[model samples]
Target: MPLADWLDRRTGWRSLAARARADLSRPVPRHVNALFALGTVAGTFLAVQVATGVLLLFHYRASADAAHGSLEALLSEVPSGWFVRSLHAWGAHLFVATLLLHMARVFVYGGYKRPRELTWILGSVLLLLGLGFAFTGSVLPWDQRAYWATTVGTRMAEAAPLVGEELLRLVRGGEEVGEATLGRMFALHVAVLPLALLPVLGAHLWLVRRLGVSTLEDADVEERVGHARLCEGGEPFFPHHVLQEAFVANLALGLLFLLAILAPAGLGPRADPLETPPGVRPEWYFLPVYQLQKYMPRSLLGIEGNTLGFLASIPPVLLLLALPFLDRSPARAPSRRKGAMALGLLVLGLGGALGVLGYLSNRTVQAFGRTFVFDDRGFPERAAGPATEPR
Candidate 1:
């Protein structure tokens, strides 16, 4: 306590403390609900990822030859190493999921309408960075699923319009996915992506702080400005908002630990170059595109079908980025903006459907009283067997 007094007197930490207190004590809209705490939940997961990653780094071997073995050792011999890795694994999924839900809430509530366009954009970028973190981190396991997934995943980049080959080479560090590819992914998962994520995340939080909570997305220009100003009526963020954030964050962390303990991350057999296993699927989030690519005809007007499929995905991403400008209506209510709401539903529904199709691809199954054979492209054809009752 005496050292704290001396440091504060000499180094002026009290001034910084005052600023922090001022920021925390600022008035925010009273209507800010649990949905508002999604950002805080995401921030909590980011901290967990960093903490767990540092622990993994101490035991992880970057080379392809040793990476899988190192993980095996960490899981079996190291204390609670499996739990730490599983936490990181499952946390990545939850982190991206919360970001998506957060963005979706903003979209539905029209939080991106006015004066907060930059915040939405920054949040979108953070979501992209979060995906990069997942993709690269998944590859670090260097096991069968990771190996083939990376192999196909990197090759899928060759579907890009013009610089496809260059992109492939750049990511692979050569013509194929091997040790060099593993090294590059390790760098991205550990260092490059994290560095890029922090600044954008900081700016997004700063904008939210300065603008206060955009409570009434349905409010028009004047009411919107007033709420942003924290004028007339609102509640202080210190105890009220902070307490809500803590509660939601505790639930999120509890769920994360539960998932980690219940279903720890799995490491399959070592990657085999000679034998490419059947029924290999990419991560869940990438399933839509994976299914889309499968449905693509081998050649679409002489251009590769997968290339066309890859190009098709660009429009949706651009739409998300330009949503604020496109939906320029003054009213923020979902009912007031039918077209945007319908389009959002269509996108989400299509993505879910495609993910389902991707999961069922390359397999045969019975459903709806008929036995259907699903091709690698997920096309269902009638089988020879008799129909069965729907379960």
Candidate 2:
């Protein structure tokens, strides 16, 4: 048989299987839940970011010397380029925000327990990967601000005690940022990270299928047993939920395109290798981590260490990774899991507090005339001089 004919023959069977599975796994609740809606919203934004990123790649140039100028030209010259870039930028933020919200909902609702633990763990990895995507993409603009901000970022990494120097060298591809660094970052941002995420994401969805969607405690599962009983049986995945997902996805795509057309991204001047810019900051997603680095004591246990900084970051990282295991209660309702509920609130409170303190530290440093300002070449223009001329 011709391939087309074979595919056509299989379509009906495929649809039937999908419908059967959906009917079996559908929520027992009569009303659609808000958590379900929120996940859909987040999934929509993720699709937008992926699509826009691909479009932007068509116009992006990777060379450090030309990358910044090319981005500027794309904004000014390409038709509707500004809107596309802005949508891409804003979409990134939206994606992170929505994912965070989704995770919170899952945590509070006891969605991470027992059979669903793997799903939650995979989702956490996805969150970290999303963050990596954001950080790598941020530096591609190659503006003075972007360059020096990344410099400070890498230095913070290098501050790790024993292994820090090696790790920094691996990230930078050398002692300093240059073409190699840009190329490596771009590769990781576009190629490596995506490749790494794909299998994990597939596994996550598979687990969702195997374990099934979580439900509020009040819903009875026995009611959702039959296939043909429309009122009692779950809706068909194809015409019901799948169609809804499609509609939401297309709506998100439309909005992203509209944004891209209305306001393309703007680019700063080309990064000069010789100078640095003042008040350089990272993308908003990194604000918490960046802030944490500031408040952590320079040393711990009198060991004389930046090791403390490295160690300080470990808890949050581990907590995020270990959430699936940490939340092992049998209860699946937010109200029932008091310990998890309290922990979630504590994490949020700490994050907010640390962010505020970090911001205050920056302000204090600037007030004391100790903050490093950068020149156009992305090098720090030192504030404290040799104190030589007075003699």
Candidate 3:
């Protein structure tokens, strides 16, 4: 009776291990394709983000006055801090990309039907929380880019019709983006949002296990006969599906590392409320919405375009949440579900188009082998120089 063996038997350690092993070894649909691997890729980067974020918090200062200085110091003075920070930054991009792909896969494969509706709802919530992480993280550096980007970004919330003003105040922590705002964003990035994400993520994963993977071959049949009858045979989750997931995870990490090293995250000048950057852009993922707000006519039907756009954005989210109910057709085949497929395509196309337009609308100008930024109104502004504290 070794001490380790005694503990394993006395505690639930052995049974817990057995149960986990069994869970991983559960059967998966034979038609579960490579797209399913996107979930693993997203989860991998999420773990990286959390790990690097914790390391960063060791040196981070969350105040508006000190936040940019702290980041500059972290890059210059702390050993390996630059690389870790770069990993975390790039991991955010990778996580968002993979998560989108995962959701698209689920949508295209008709995986969000019947008993799995709650799983889809939970995942949709995670998507919004993921974007929250991106928005809050963008403001943490407290640099010129961060300050103006956040200032402009939060302004969109002020278009929420009746509650817009209150929403803007709630987000900014006051009348403007300053000390109070920085504190709120920092708390959200490091504590509040992460705490909220954990339980929802756990429930999503548990639902996947409880219901099993959806199959394409019998989608049409299952829609009518129910998913239980379609689960006739498949491969085990371990070794087979897990190996594919492992491969995708490794590929995602490799790409993240390459980007981190080649184009490491750079800190910019500290935020100055008195000065505005020439061209401030929100993170790429938010570019579509930003572009829409920027280019859309100021007035639509005598209403403010910003308010109209803000209200318009609400329906798509509601539509996604209501997808399982709306798409009640008992056929999962793409050809059979023409309306759903068409709508998915339109959404995807519009997002891609808006992203391109956002990039094109940026007012970056080149001169003397150096790039200079300008305000959206085309006024000349100072360049955000190298990642170093000014003497």
**Regions of model 3 farther than 4 Å from truth:** 217-220, 223-233, 300-302, 364-391
Q: Please estimate how well model 3 matches the true structure, expressed as its whole-model Cα lDDT.
A: 0.84
- Pairs of colliding residues, candidate 3: 278-374, 278-375, 279-374
Clashes (N, CA, C under 3 Å) per candidate: 0, 16, 3
- Report the C-alpha lDDT of model 3 over 71-182, residue by residue, as the tens digit: 9999999998899999998998888888889999999888887667899999989889999999999899898999999999999989988899999999999999999999
Encode model 1's per-residue lDDT on 1-391: one tens digit a residue: 9999999999899899999998888777766789989989999999999999999999999998999999999999999999999999999999989988999988888888777788888888898899899999989988889989888888888889899999899999999789999999999988899889889988998998887677664546636456646434566788877998999999999999999999998889987767798878899988887788877788878898879888887887888888888887767778888999999999999999998999888787876666888877677865837776657
Off by over 4 Å in 2: 1-6, 9-32, 218-264, 359-391
Provide the overall lDDT of each model, using Cα atoms, as 2-decimal numbers: 0.87, 0.71, 0.84
Estimate TM-scores for all models.
Answer: 0.93, 0.80, 0.89
Model 2 has a clash total of 16
- Once model 2 is optimally superposed onto the true structure by TM-score, how far is the C-alpha of residue 294 displaced, in angstroms? 1.4
Worst lDDT window (10 residues) for model 1? 224-233
Better of 1 and 2 by TM-score: 1
